[model samples]
Target: MQEIHPLLQPKKYRFIDQSTLGPGFSALQSFAMDDALSISVGEQISPTAARLWVHHNTIVLGIPDARLPYIDKGMDYLHEAGYEVIIRNSGGLAVVLDEGVMNLSLIFPNSKDLNIHEGYDAMVEFVRFLFADLTDEIEAYEITQSYCPGKYDLSIGGKKFAGISQRRVKQGSAVQIYLDVTGSGYERAALLKHFYEISKLGEETRFEYPTIDPSVMASLNELLGTSLTVEDVRERILKQLSEFSEAVVTHPLEGEEIEWFTKRLDQMIVRNEKARENLK
Candidate 1:
């Protein structure tokens, strides 16, 4: 689907703008809240949430990321290096998160008519339109050598700056993405590459994971040849959401949502524990 056609599918997205949250409680809380909100508000609410959040010096790893042969060593490396590594209950592999990185979650109610590809396409289309003013060359193809390579890896000129993943709770689908708004994307890639090397240590596994070439990643500031900050992209995100919605209102996690998050947080911790065990 191209520009005009996809924009026509204006699914109402909620605006949970928390663009300046740090490590520990804030990141964990927001993720758990949104994960639970996606399920509780799925079909009944039919409300899609567009959340913007940032965490400093954190590495959000995928479920499979913990399956790396050298995971213990990898996590140790990251921890010793002063990065907080946590396993995310979403799709995609390990990705660096910091104040410079901006994350958006487009939560949609899953209709019987919608499949996984459609869910992925909705975000692909939303993102394409989100940056329509900048350039139309953004392609959603698998950028090999890019960490977390998938069909939804959004790239410009062969270098990837954004990756999208999905989380389904009941009938709600949360398509989340981490945009490397600023900073050294190559540095992040290098870190993942090192993580892989430390984990694998030349041992073979059936999973067939990525070796990460570091060169295939770069920040939007580097790609655009201009100094653009996460706040700049954050503004662009708000403007784009307004263009697609009937009303753009800021909402917080309700008490019920908080309770669901508490439960989900426990599940997330369990998943993280199991993930960490796989590294050994």
Candidate 2:
């Protein structure tokens, strides 16, 4: 087993658990919240922070996804299928987020000194530790046929259960990951497969989008042969975080942090609107 990165072992961590916020807690706000936390940590106004969140039936698209030849039609299909769509201000292809998916963001300061791979490694190591008790077969590598495939995709055997992406801002880094803790990973991947078929319509482009194969994905419950709910994983995360830190504190955003969140949220909304305008 690889040693946990020092970045993942903070002396103290500000832990924010928003997983129970329900459907009203939009992914739009989640991304903005991460930026806010990044700035807060970078400015030394807050300690290294971790946030857990879940959104209901949303498909977060990458910037390139927004440029798909028939994306307006693709968005319409998703809307009809009862999924909200948004373009994220981060790196990676499209990914599914729903009640069964648990998302985590680890915000670290001094990004200038943090190598990009270090941020990714910290997340990989932390996740390995999160479920070390349940199974030791967890692996990190690109699951090319899976939706949102990446070099840091977490898997068991040959099936992927999670994907990691990172964003850097104001000298802080947010290494974000989405874990498919429950539900059907095949159904989720199928959604994206249909989405890409409609969005690209067999049209070729400069950047190649993934050719998704639903079988390449599976929920943790399926892989580990254990019934693990998002809530179950939520508790596990908090417990693991406590082990990694000397103290775990829940600190709400205040004053300037609130202002920063609002500013970043507005920017996200504007970006989404502009991306939509290109379709019209």
Candidate 3:
């Protein structure tokens, strides 16, 4: 196994887990929270932080996804299907978030000196370490037929189970990943596939959206043949963090961090509304 990146070797890490917050925890707040942590870490007010979040039955779309010719209809279809849709402030196509999916964010400072691929590699290495005991077959490569496909997509046996995205703010970087811990990955992919089908309507567009193949995706439980819940993965993450750092401290947002979160949340709301309206 490759050595973990130095960025992952911090002496202390601030840990925040929001996975059990239930249905009210919106993806918007999650993104804003990451931004606040990024700014705090970049300014040296806080140590490098790792946050865990989960949103129920929501579809987070990339900025370009808003430009689909018939996005309004697609949004309606998702809403009618009991899913909340929002545009994320990061790069990546649409991805499904549900009780079965777990999202993790690692915020690091001095991003100016950090290569983009280095940040990604840190995440890849950490995940592989987390599941090293279960299987060593995890691979990082573009799973072209999966929803939110990217070069950093994590897969096993050519079937994707996770996708990663990164956002930078105030010289700090947040490397975010969504892992399909438990559930039917095919159902999730089929949802996004139908979304693109309705949104594009076969209309030729400049930005090419992925042609999702639901069969190319599977949850960890399905692939590993072990029933692991989101909470199980959450425990594994905290355990690994403790082993990697001198101390893993559970901390809540305080002082200026709360103010930063409020501002970032407002910005995200405005950005989302404008993107949706422009498409309409």
Q: What is the Å distance of residue 150 in model 3 from its true position? A: 0.6
Error of model 3, residue 180, in angstroms: 0.1
Q: C-alpha displacement of 59 in model 2, angstroms?
A: 0.5
**What lDDT does candidate 2 reach at residue 93?**
86
Q: Write the per-residue lDDT of candidate 3 for residues 164-246, one digit (tens) a residue.
A: 99999988999999999998999999999999999999999999999999999999999999989999999999999998899
Q: What is the C-alpha lDDT of each candidate?
A: 0.79, 0.92, 0.94
TM-score of 1: 0.92
lDDT digits (tens) for residues 32-111 of candidate 2: 99999999999989999999999999999998888788889999999999998898865578999999999999999999
TM-score of each: 0.92, 0.98, 0.98
Report the candidate with higher TM-score, 1 versus 3. Answer: 3
lDDT, candidate 1, 95-148, per-residue tens: 888778888887777534477787788777777887777778888899889888
Error of 3 at 250 (Å): 1.1
Residue pairs with backbone overlap in model 3? none
- Residue 200, model 2, lDDT: 88
Give the distance in Å from residue 34's predicted Cα in candidate 3 to where it truly belongs. 0.4
Better of 2 and 3 by lDDT: 3
RMSD of 2: 1.1
